[model samples]
Target chain A: MGGDLGPRATVEGTARALQSQSRLSACVFGPRALLAAEVDALPADLRVAAERLTLCDAPRVIDQAMKPSQALRAPRDSSLAMMLASIADGQADAGVSAGNTGALMALARRALGTVAGIPRPAISTAVPTRAGGRCYLLDLGANVEASADRLVDFALMGAVMARRVDGLVAPRVALLNIGVEGTKGSASVREADALLREFAGLDYRGFIEGDGIYSGQVDVVVCDGFVGNAVLKASEGLARMLMERVQATFEAHWSSRLVGLLARPALRRLKRELDPVRYNGASLLGLNGIVVKSHGGADAAGFGCAVGRAMQEVDQALPRHLARELDYWRRANASVACGRGVSGADPRRMDADNPQR
Target chain B: MGGDLGPRATVEGTARALQSQSRLSACVFGPRALLAAEVDALPADLRVAAERLTLCDAPRVIDQAMKPSQALRAPRDSSLAMMLASIADGQADAGVSAGNTGALMALARRALGTVAGIPRPAISTAVPTRAGGRCYLLDLGANVEASADRLVDFALMGAVMARRVDGLVAPRVALLNIGVEGTKGSASVREADALLREFAGLDYRGFIEGDGIYSGQVDVVVCDGFVGNAVLKASEGLARMLMERVQATFEAHWSSRLVGLLARPALRRLKRELDPVRYNGASLLGLNGIVVKSHGGADAAGFGCAVGRAMQEVDQALPRHLARELDYWRRANASVACGRGVSGADPRRMDADNPQR
Candidate 1:
């Protein structure tokens, strides 16, 4: 439905998700023949329930430089388009893909539509923290540049996801900046900080330094997509480099190998705890329906996890909750604006009548 | 003779350097009384030779909103001014400070002057890689925005330092970017990549991904100061967060404590291997003399290590080597310019002969 490896990984993933989650049902959308072939190839015990797998015959698009119309039109004849159509038609609650990120984003924007008042949809990823810990970071690579308003929306969406999905309550949200003070970052970050401060439902924790991302200091971290993308990539790079070094060190000598043997259990536990596949899926927030982007390099297992995550979002009615929150933000901002008698002033502030300022 | 922590840390560090390397001498610049007190406090075995600790009593200008003139114009009695004067007057081979980085950079610029043909100086930090690992990343936090030309200079300076100090024969250099391809970055990165491709002396590895920073894949990583500063802080934050988690995990339960005991040797080895104090110094590159900045939060141990690092730079004759290389770059660029008959065109390109259509 997505790209070259789409049908196979998606089929296997669907099978695994069915077996692991008893209540889950999957409606796979793609060329019916290919989907059937992939499902049929699965081991007998792992075969997906035929009734649960709904196949839509749509052609796939693969080139990166293809014109948007051509790319969008091609996917229409393939599984991804059918999946979006299913969501739009209320036949499917959510859709998940391991395809071109840009294409997926475009299709979601075109079909699912944005939450009212939200400027742009953000992609949020859960990164492994130290000691079996993890936190959700938003706008991983969705929009390259974001307005202060978009950042505020990201904060609200990220916090809601963390609480509902990760079970963190009244999540502490921090705006990522160069420093922790009010005047520390670019004009955008400072403005975002001000906007965040006035947000009614958020547990705003002021600014967080870059290092705080992995410190487990806050549950939800927000930033413009450009900085967020760079930071996420950097963290991924560091983890890979560390793992490589550990491997090389263990393989260096007999003594180190013996030491490695003693540390094998801990190392394996650490590896599983930090495995990207276990946490490889990113949810595109502010969309009308659930859509998760699995890592492009994800194998069968990773793809399976993304499917499970997508199912969870659908069952939990995350989009409904997000819409309600967006309503709350709009009403609150509107009331504040009315009180101030200023049409364009930011409402995320201490009201003049409330002497706190 | 820099900031409040200068005299004590500098004296102690100098003493350590002298004790470790008998070939070195240090000139302590500060209020003579303070320098004498610090010198007296050093252990007899670690104390420098009398002839080595030449004190220059210089007064200081201190104010919260200190004016540039107030900060810059040393009352002929200021320790910082005297220290720079010593370097300028040939009374010292290099200047080292544990003072305000801004003030030190300004003083150095005013006194020793920038390397000929270089626009601005860069600050480079040698980050520890895994075993047999070391990489120099620049402008840690010095210049927020750097031109392509300045980045080339940083690469050259970093390569020289890595070779002379870290012992890389022909250090592989890489431009730090979002992706490891020529076309995958902002306008500045793409331009810098093109410029760097022309420098023949360096073992130019193409764009390096973020994770490659600690992979020891390359010896020198170049970037403008803004991104560099963010990356550096994030890494430091992650390391600290990990250390804290390790401690907390060890202390969580009786069984974990027992496991901690069993893992003590390995943990200790890792801590020692990753200790920041052992590698928490940054060198100010492209200056007339060597100036290393210790972390502002450095304690005695950290400061001691910074001193050792400064001594290493002196031993390596880093300043002279950098000057020689810069002169070579200038001459090569100038000749290429002459050949192309375009006075200001970039000389780094080999395609100068083929004018654009």
Candidate 2:
């Protein structure tokens, strides 16, 4: 409801999700009249599927301009707040939004709290790779300056998400750095690298450069919010630019345009395979409840993907899995520390985030 | 000589450059016999132009696995060192390398030294934009954690390069951050934003996210090496993936294969437009002598592009322009600081890298 496209895309996307996922019921929180009208304006089949969708009145909207603190101080009647509240109140198994990220993150953290041993929930999303698989990138905008231990936390959380949400038995986790050399990156990354080398419950790959993100070499790439955000956005920009260039090339000549028509199916499949809309859903990982954040400018298909992502998390019980895996790590770390006298094979000490002792 | 693809690409690329630029002469520094073999292997047309190319025997090799400090400690007979020495000895106006980035930057800064008011050289390159224009991105991996002042210095250098090399009236310079808001980035970026707003040298467009880089709205984007490196590599990765995906799409089905043949010209043009080889050259800015770094894995065409970029920098005297523009800003800053009683403007103070007062 608080997205850039108003209620049109969300309502239409909700109808689409309901149509596709038969058991999925949506509680759309927005201005009831506006949502109802948008729902009525949908196509016949989708409109009929709207019977599974209910609307709640949330007149207030948190826009992109509002700061996180300012958003918290504002009225609780905002759509972002109400949606998270619905999750906390147990009326919804999961929630999704395309609102101001800072506002949504802050509100969701407050409403749902965080998982055990996790102070802040990080944002995680799967990016399309060259192998037709997905590589998960985390801390997209949660903590701007994650410490070395926080990076370890991100690796753990991201590995958990990749394993459960994406059905990977043992996800390959790597820290994002400028270079692959041991001495190439920031101090925190180096420290995290040393820790992850031994703190393994999963396959801990070494440092990965940004170019390797799409190479499909690693399953999960962990970084601070700043680096993650920059990489994701820049990748999106480059993808869009390439897609446009492809289209413009087809439109250059009449013969080429005719060829484009013949190749429409292949081109269309290429576009679909590489579309950002299909990957619009970003999971706010390490939260007590399931929440997915869609791109604000996403179309109906994109928003529907976010809804689908939320449903997947709900079905997988992602948060519970994260907690269980994290607890196992804590116990493993504790035993290792006790056995090794806190100096040998005790990688937990390398993490400043060791639950703050 | 230190790149992933040995001297083959470098020697062939030099021949190609010599063939294209009638006046361009190069002193190839590798094993003389090896380079001679590669030179003799070129096409007859290119071999004839290879008359202007001279081969200097550099028997020592510094592989990518070596650290920067270790590279310096190693024998100076390496091809990388000889290339810089040629430039320093006034035999060459510029130098290009596809060696290890850390080694290259370290060696170049040591050999060429830095411009006045700048302590280090930043890696700068032009990325293709949506509008068929190029946007300069700097500090690609030179300084991983650039301070606020370093970011400002990058902005100035990038703006000068854009103005002279690209010949824009006034480059729209921007600070790369996660979000555009004043409160949305790291402390250094925020401080640089305040500084750039009042610095009064170039047209500072304030903050730009990684996604906005390709929008063609700005001519220059400045960021720390870590963020810049991540965004750049991710972009290159994405572009490569997209190109491969397009090719795979064409080869998908039999009917599509016919369409691909029909659309070969258009598809070729699109591939040519988006190829990473076209943007291979990365200029090492702020150095006293011109140096361009090609991709380590670049093909002959890519390495030739790097040589071409070096020639362009030499022709335009990019380093001199940067020094002059930076001096202008310094004088402007000094006058404003005096007139405003040090509180009015004084963006220089905002930059902790202000030559230590």
- For all the candidates, what are their Cα RMSDs to the real structure? 7.0, 4.9
Q: Across all candidates, what is each one's fraction of true contacts kept?
A: 0.28, 0.92
* Model 1 lDDT tens row, A206-268: 988778888877888887665676677667666665555555555456665665665555556
lDDT at residue B166 of model 2 (Cα atoms): 82
Q: How many backbone clashes does candidate 1 have?
A: 11
Worst 10 residues of 1 chain B by lDDT: B348-357
Identify the candidate with maximal DockQ: 2
User: For each candidate, what's the DockQ?
Assistant: 0.31, 0.79
True contacts kept of 1: 0.28
Kindly list the per-residue Cα lDDT of model 2 for residues B1-357, writing each as its tens digit.
856777889988888998999989889998888988988888787878789889899998778888999988888899999888888777889998988888888888787777645788899989999989989998898999998878988998998888888888989999989999999999999988987888876799999988889989899999999989989988888888888899889988898888888888998898788777888899988887889999988988899999999888888878766666676675677643333233333344433222210
Choose the strongest candidate by lDDT. 2
In candidate 1 chain A, what residue range of length 10 has the lowest lDDT sum? A348-357
